[model samples]
Target: MSRSTSTPAAPATPTTPATHGPVRIGAQARTAQRPTVDPVVSGGFWYDRRRTVARVAIPQGPGLLESAGNLHDLRLAAGAADGPFRGDYPFMDSDVYKWLEAASWQLGQAPDGEHGAAAEASLAEHMEKIIALVADAQQPDGYLNSWFQSGKGDGPFLDLRWGHELYCAGHLIQAAVAHHRATGADSLLQVARRFADHIDATFGTPDSGKPVDGIDGHPEVETALVELYRETGERRYLDLAGYFVDRFGHGRLGGERYCQDRVPLRQADNVEGHAVRQLYLLAAAADLATETGDDELGAAAARLWHAMVATKTHLTGGVGAHHDEEDFGDPYELPNERAYCETCAAIASIQFSWRMALLTGQARYSDLIERTLFNGFLAGMSLDGERWLYVNPLQVRDGHTDTGDDQSARRTRWFRCACCPPNVMRLLASLEHYVSASDGSGLHLHQYVSGRYRGETDRGLPIFVNVNTDYPWQGRITVTVEECPDMPWTLSLRIPQWCRDYTLSVDGVPSARTQNEAPAQDGWLRVERVWTAGDALVLDLDLPVRLVEADPRVDAVRGCVAIERGPLVYCVEQVDHPGGGLDDVVLDPSRPLSAKDRPDLLGGVVTVVGAGYRRRLAPSGWWPYQDRTDAERGDHASPVGTGEPVELTAVPYYAWANREDGSMRVWLPTD
Candidate 1:
């Protein structure tokens, strides 16, 4: 399991399927053709460059990488032959292995010293140590896992629903693939294959005499197996992956008792259930369709994407409606106060959206990613980037303190299951991968952050893009293109869904075209003249304050509304109004809210000021159903609510909890 510093071997060529199996309900069976890797995974801006720079700016930067690197080093320290896992925390130990594997694949894609050789070595050592631990704990039948292995005598596979046996296997398979790809080593791959083969042999066959339940409590294995099939080109792996997907909604898989069981996978109208698990399953299904050429599966994924965006999604592109269930609420039932936007869910949603964008060539998918990245994803980490918010609520009640019982529904330093911290670190460390993508014909500019990109277009033309702009804070983006080949190539600039109006400029010439303009003649802006290094394009999107109200169906807020600018949802904190309750808050949509730049606040957030009323106690006289009530209850007074005019300020919901520990609410009742 321990990997050497030597370079990894070339990726193995995919094999042709000798025999074919019947396609299960949701399964995409492989034929004779070999499966290819997703272009998104193979080529993208590296994560280390795009996400890590911002991450290291936070307070916990040292511990973030230290923990991850330590985990990685432990594996390498243990030879591929044998070593101990050597970690006090079992969950962290497991995650360290996962990160090592993911990091390995990234390193293999572009092995350079920029990522730090020492860091890489440490990761390899940790991986090796964990593999040795796995080997020592593995059962004779090829089952491997420390937690499950230890509990075998009393109850082996007794609680597959919550135990996460398959989930661990999925991570193992992922790490194995990543390490093999990065180091060209087979020791870990061999171990992964044995475990995978055992899983395929143990689960899901009418004749195997094992349980026929096709679903996993955690939906990761489906995606992992699909990746394995892509890497190995083995038909069996693809079949098994498909089987998991198909078995997902059928009664044979024990129905949707856990999550999403009420409806079949293909028939499910929206993204629901555990936030992370649902998105992972969707991503895997998308990969399966691409790998197996299953049009039906692809259509299902597309429908799900649209449904999520249209109904379940927030203005910031965050999903997962209710904090209580950590699941989807009724369509358009988005309540800011009760919103439980888990950090992991946002990451998974972005992954799923990115995959969809790749498959369909739609800018909307990328648009969603941009929204989530700027808002929901950004909210996951504190301004300093050290502390993390497990649950990102749309609204925080002013003066309200969260009790420990609702930790999952609030932000915290750490959790008993501290998966998000490291996960956030790794994601941030590798954010560059999500920026722009090339399809050979043209380059797709998904996000508008200031940066430079050098990559080959799908047509193999060397393309260089240097973008300069202040994004999220400002809407101006200047993109310079160079190295155009003899043949004309198109460049697709994403027009964000939120951008009601935008101006386009080519080579410094302002075009009259706006968002309403017709699609470019060639399905892309045509630059007939031979392009030079200085060729430039400028885009300006209007980022203005916009009022947002929840659907009438959401019972939590019958007559309330929230505000948003760009992708951030705004909230009114009690700190802004010392004694005035949010209930006294009301927005006069007619009176436009002004946006003022306040750099003094977290990350230069935009503040919106408006006129509203402050609630005050009022005296009331008792009334009776009959006309004589005034005399019968003479001089009797009761407390009644009254409002006084006041000025209110609102900040982004993501920035609320970062300020003074006071209550905040997103939705304010209007009188």
Candidate 2:
């Protein structure tokens, strides 16, 4: 439990900064004037506000605060003070400290740097201690792993299949990158680079004479390498990333041993095997394709994206099937009660989709990200933002909850393999990073929200974009060009695939509009106008109740149905219907589902009221063939169904299980 405050060496290019020229500060930054109704907000730029801040703010803010506070208290209770280590997960003290580092990185990047100083200090000290521990434990070849180095002596790199060496490295790299970006402290970055270099030398026959195929069984190293390359722009880093992608599906690195080696990496379409691993690999492939401009790799990524959206994805854009291994079950086999929508998996899926949107400029990727952000991702955090659910299931059977039965499938305060909490923290902390992207032609406002972007445009123009909105809860964004070069640049605003009716306005005047436009073709409304300081653009998208049906092949639902409004999916919990069997219930789609502002619920949950039926007992022996006589049959019959006027309350699929403990079902069987 040691912490170091020493800053590591700067990157190899000490004098070179990532950005070109000097950073521009907006001179005339002003709050956008409120516009009249009748506009649409489309894009992921401000979508994270609804997803991460509004929906998950309660859970993430309070949950991490409480967890970290508890860990701090535990460390104090153990008589451990002054040193740099915190308590690990609830039980084992394995690599739980890594989660703390990751969480610190995330807190440092959060809005207004809420807990930035403490988080940065904690990460720096913890990383220093970890580096020392690694140095002391290494075998002098620069190879370091806490699990293997603490007298495990298993081997230099044994159990690549199940061992979490690379997975741990990936998390460390993420923390390092986040810390470096948030604080410009290269201490942990230097340690991470050294570890990455050691990994490169040991595996893949780079430095070692071993001809072993080099690939982490878990597909995270690829993503880390891609991020590293992006940060440093080292060709070898990109080459190493490609090496991982190339090795995938080649049967080179224990084919199918980790479920990634079975099919060629290009051939693996649907998100198979481990949910987190699958999404991470897809993200890396997308990064590689974008950075290298490799058509083959892009095509592979495209095929996989289609397969995942078409078959494996849930209504909430959640992936993974079996609750057992948190892995994929089958194509379109999404089960409401049995789903294992790991929070980390949802975050990874969003990351993958966001990268894809940037790479291909396809609105479908943004669509997927929107769906997951509002539903699956939001469901991971609790209503108060203090507690978190590791497994986000669509339904839960009453009395027999997954909590006590299956440890991995249950929602615990903390876990020994504690990656989800900190992963969520980082995602929320760096949410703005996923909001917008620019490639010079025009500013691509991928999401809609109230924020500001001050960066050099692709054309080297000093561009400043200020977005103002109250989104997800409301859809109206006023984007003002606070500062830009006096040139006609295309301002591309993404019209979400879900939005059916939208109106656009430029310079406070009504402009062209479209209805039910194809998201991929016309998702973006290009406003090519002579822009100057104080030019305003407004977009308003209609939000209506959307009835979403599952694939017919999904046997889990049968005649069941679910409801969706805006991007949020609605489900019925048994608590709302006492003694009402979900099987006997049915949704009256004709009934209108309204958005009620319930401050008591998670960021104001949407409630639905519907009608259904109930079952009552009948005679016992009416249909008994062998043992029943006519008189017996007349007196005792089988159970009879009774139709009663039933009113049931339904909450957003993500908001279920927070209320009274009861049976919950997203897909209720229709009689």
User: What are the RMSDs of all candidates, in order?
Assistant: 7.9, 9.0
Q: Write the per-residue lDDT of candidate 2 for residues 467-570, one digit (tens) a residue.
A: 77656656777888888887777777888777787777888788855445644472677777778899898888887766666778988776667777666678
Runs in model 2 lying further than 4 Å from the true structure: 1-140, 205-212, 403-410, 454-458, 519-522, 578-583, 615-642
What is the TM-score (0 to 1) of candidate 1? 0.78
Cα misplacement distance, residue 645 of candidate 2 (Å): 1.9
Q: Point out where model 1 deviates above 4 Å.
A: 1-94, 101-142, 152-158, 176-191, 207-213, 323-325, 399-401, 405-410, 454-458, 515-530, 579-581, 617-645
Q: How many pairs of residues collide in each model?
A: 36, 28
Model 1 lDDT at residue 216 = 63
The sequence of per-residue lDDT tens digits that candidate 1 reaches over residues 519-596 is 443123333334567889888778888776666766777777777787667778777887655644565555668888
